[model samples]
Target: MQWIENGDLSFLDNRGMNGFLEYEKAVREIIAKVRVNGDKALLSYTKQFDHVDLETLHADSEHIATAYRDLPGTFIEVIKEAAGNIRSFHEKQKPDSWDVTHADGSRLGQRVTPLDAVGVYVPGGTAAYPSSVLMGAIPALVAGVKRIVLVSPPQKNGEISDGVLAAANEIGIKEIYQVGGAQAIAALAYGTETIKPVDKIVGPGNIYVTAAKKEVFGTVAIDSLAGPSEIVILADDSANPDWLAADLLSQAEHDPLSMAILVTTSKSLGKAVESHIQKQVRSLPRAEIAKKSLDDFGKIILVEDYDDGIKTVNKLAPEHLEIVVTNPEQILPEVRHAGAIFIGAYSSEPVGDYFAGPNHIIPTNRTARYSSPLSVESFVKRSSIIQYSFEAMQNNGRKIAEFARYEGLEAHARAIEKRIQE
Candidate 1:
């Protein structure tokens, strides 16, 4: 980890996205083939890319049942607990339809409605993310989405991850397909023979999947263009240097591009954290990846005071933020950006990633400035509700027509004028 003082911090901006342009041609072709060939393209791509031949595309009850039989009871219990937490948090976020009536008898409001269907892409092949299944599916279910579909790549045994299946089963999601990558994304956007099309798609994947999501965004709503994971810790002399080092490594181990940084008022604490990270990186299982991430993106930034630290962290607007100062309450309100905020020493980034009720699928690459963490809101759509009484239209009709004509939209003017009482 490198140490720097609070001067020109523009070097840490991280403006560029992952190598997206490199994959655009490939992704466009994959989407085109899936749209034209449907199930044939999905099956052929599965066999070609995943190197596994599957007899069927859909996962039946037997698949989930086998997962329960094989998985450890303790792991199942933990998954249930995590799922409950995620569900409870999102349920609080559920939106209700509301309307307000004006004095002129005009009713205007928003009618909140869930999408007809949603697709959750869980990455499979090298790793099984049971956690992702819970994060991505539970919110849509809480939002009242009627259909929830799960897609993941099959492994060498021609089966999806048991852990993933177990998570899906926990969430009451039965519609799952054994397919992944850009082709699977296409299938989710446009229906195949085996899989029904979803109105929206949510979850994270490799660069190819990310590229596919970018391509299919207009065809179907997507969660966000997620970038590499990142974290910014605003700490002081109060924060334990050892714990801070371990926390930084949490994001670092995720990928070679993942960024971890410490913004602190105390120079001594920054140095200590940097030293601890060097020592900790050697012992981790993903040492090679963590080492590369730390070498490239990790930093220990020194600030003049608490105000200075907060200002710098706000500009970064990292995906995950932790405030471990002597008085976190004082700093919490000042934070204008960050996908998720962990307030104290106990509230580590991983705690939110796993057990905590908050969704771990947060905006990365400084997107938190405008975007937000994946939540119940991500699964629902809002339709503007308008009901103008004759009296209301009589009052505003001519003005609206005049305004429409100003924009040179005569048809729009006539539509309103037709409703107005002479």
Candidate 2:
């Protein structure tokens, strides 16, 4: 890890937005082929890119059932517990249709409705993440989304991972596709012969998949233009070095570009944490990936005081922020932006990632400054409900006409005038 006694935070301004522009040309071609050729194009790309040849793309009930049964009883129990937690959290977020009546008897309110269908993309190949399926699909289920289609890349043997399939079956998601990457996104946005288009797509993927989502956004809603995973730690003398190092490595192992930063008031604690990271990383299975991430994006900034650490962190606007100072809550009020805040040393990043019930599908690459984590809101649509009573219109029609006239909208003014004349 590189240490800076006192460094400018500008270097962290835009982390993951630059390199994907070059992949746009290739991503566009993939989308066009899928749009024109339908399932034929989808199958061809699946075989070519994923190196898996298949006569069929869909995973039927028998296949999913087999996958679910194949898992150990212990693993299944843990998944069930985690699902319960997630469902309970998102159930609270479900909104109801409500209306308010004004003194003039004018009723105006909001009607919240779930989208008809949603597509969830799960990354495949070297890694298999059952947790991701739970994080993305459970909220859609709670939002009452009627159809949930899951797309994942098949392995060299032309089979989806059992873990992913188990998670999907756990949530009662039956429409599963064994295709992934840009073509899968295209098929979801613009329906193929077998696969149907959806209202919105949510999940994480590589650059090609992200670019495809960006291109097809207007055609179908997307959660966000997600980038690499990231986390930032704000620690003081009270923080534990071993725990801090473990937390930082959890995010760093995600990708080579994933960021792990530390802003501390004590210089000695920073050095101790750095030593612990080096020792801990040596034993990790993905040590090579974590090592590259640390060398490229990892940082340790030693600030003069706690106030200085908080000020610098707001500028970073990390996806996950861990406040491990003397009193973590005291610093939370000053934290302006972050996708998720893990308070104190006990509240680690993985707790939220898996069993804690909060969605792990968080905005990355400094987008936490504006965007938010995925939730029930991502799967639902809201509409304004307005019904003006006769008396209310009669009382305000002239004022409404004059305001319309001020805007030079003659038709709008005349419409109000006609209503008033009635």
- TM-score (all chains, Cα) for each model: 0.95, 0.98
Candidate 1 residue-wise lDDT at 289: 92
Per-candidate Cα lDDT values, in order, are 0.91, 0.91
Question: In model 2, where is the ten-residue run with the lowest total lDDT?
Answer: 6-15
Residue-level lDDT of model 2, residues 131-156, one tens digit each, is 88999899999999999999999877
The deviation in Å at residue 321 for candidate 2 is 0.9
Candidate 1 lDDT by residue in tens digits, 296-382: 888888888888888898989999999998989999999999999999999989999988899989998888999999999998889
Kindly provide the TM-score of model 2 when superposed on the true structure, using C-alpha atoms: 0.98
| Model 1 quality (TM-score) | 0.95
Pull out the clashing pairs in model 2. none
